[model samples]
Target: MAGHSKWANIQHRKGRQDAKRGKIFTKLIKEITVAAKMGGGDASTNPRLRLAIEKAKGQSLPKDNIDNAIKRGTGQLEGVVYEEVRYEGYGIGGAAVMVDCLTDNKTRTVADVRHAFNKNGGNMGAEGSVAFQFKHCGQMIFAPGTDEARLMDAAIEAGAEDVVTNDDGSIEVITPPNDLATVLEGLEAAGFKAEFAEVVQKPLNESVIGGDDAMKMQKLLDALESLDDVQEVYTSAVIDE
Candidate 1:
């Protein structure tokens, strides 16, 4: 799950992933297979695949599993044929939410997603209902107290679209979705590594929901993310973390 304002702290998020490693691995495998399928099996020639592999490695996914997923994607091995699907909805306080999924059964996936929203104080939205509120872009977030000046220079040279320093002092580097890997490599080479980096549906603006509403919003997000077919969940809701 990803949030724009007052996003979960990096360490806290990492801890959550550690607790849900099994589910995380399942999602990562699906991502690797889908990436390889869409962009061939060669990571060196496919930016999406390269990024997917990097993420898998970061999570300690086994080499054999990664290799097998790639082979399955390239049709060298048989695997479930999956299709990509996206669902949009409104959460507590009507904050916009988007869920990205990869599934072999669209009927089951949609039903699960709709059920999640309906049961979690959220309402499912039609296609394009809330899409305009987001920007599909690459995002890299650096911990606070980094050398912003140096990072800015590096980001510019790396072809990043924008560099923003949030009120909390965390830095955000934005790039075209396709340039994520290139920009990430350049930044790392320049001694500015991000704590989190990925292509995502970034909210154009955030809607702050606090107190009871915040808890409800989080529950809604967690419900959607818990779906097996859901690969990612993005929301415009900002909650006290």
Candidate 2:
């Protein structure tokens, strides 16, 4: 349950993602559109679309934007097609990094990611290189006001594995990969509101970094995440700074 402790590491990444609200809107819009196109627009009926809409709501994205995005996905409006891409690499301190992207151009996306890594003191690794350092899991962030004991009790019942507080005062709930959606549904049924919920890669062991290496690592991660094609960036560099 505790091979890594990159709490501060991820909070910083999330802040940067939020900073580009327009891009965030674009990403979420694409996700909602794709989900609705594939599974129909009813949030109650399509889990993927529901999650996409919920994520947009958490970001306070306009309802019109959300609707338009859904339309584009369903072909009522024009939209570019996107493909899912993954890149693994090493950041400062030799920590493993994983970036998930949604892009229309594979070649350009790869080149952009490589350039970002090189410019910021990192090297994108070959396929399956850094990826093996992590495992997939379902993760959710809960509001700060939840009763810890009650939450722990409920989560355990719903197959959750652990709950930890982030450096910025948020709470992260982890569950087995297969149990992620189930646990989240249970939590929601029980009246708990989560800010962000998704299945993601969790690093097994962290690279303890400090000083200049830490700064470099932060910069590299930030650069990778800022790319429009990049949807998520994960690393195992546990930095206290």
Taking the candidates one at a time, how many backbone clashes does each contain?
0, 0
lDDT of each residue in 1-241, candidate 1, tens digit only: 2244433655555676788899999999899999989999999899889999999999999999999999999999999988999999899988999999999999999999999999989999999999999999999999878898999999999999999987777889999999999999999999987899999999998887879998898888878888899999888877776
Please, what are the lDDT tens digits per residue for candidate 2 over residues 60-153? 9999999988888778888888777899898986799999988889999999999999999999999999888887888887655567677777
- Stretches of candidate 2 exceeding 4 Å from the true structure: 1-11, 37-40, 142-146, 159-171, 176-182, 188-196
Clashing pairs in 1: none
Each prediction's TM-score against the native?
0.96, 0.84
| lDDT by candidate, in order shown | 0.89, 0.80
The CA-based lDDT of model 2 is what? 0.80
Q: Best candidate, TM-score-wise?
A: 1
Estimate candidate 1's alpha-carbon lDDT, on a 0 to 1 scale: 0.89
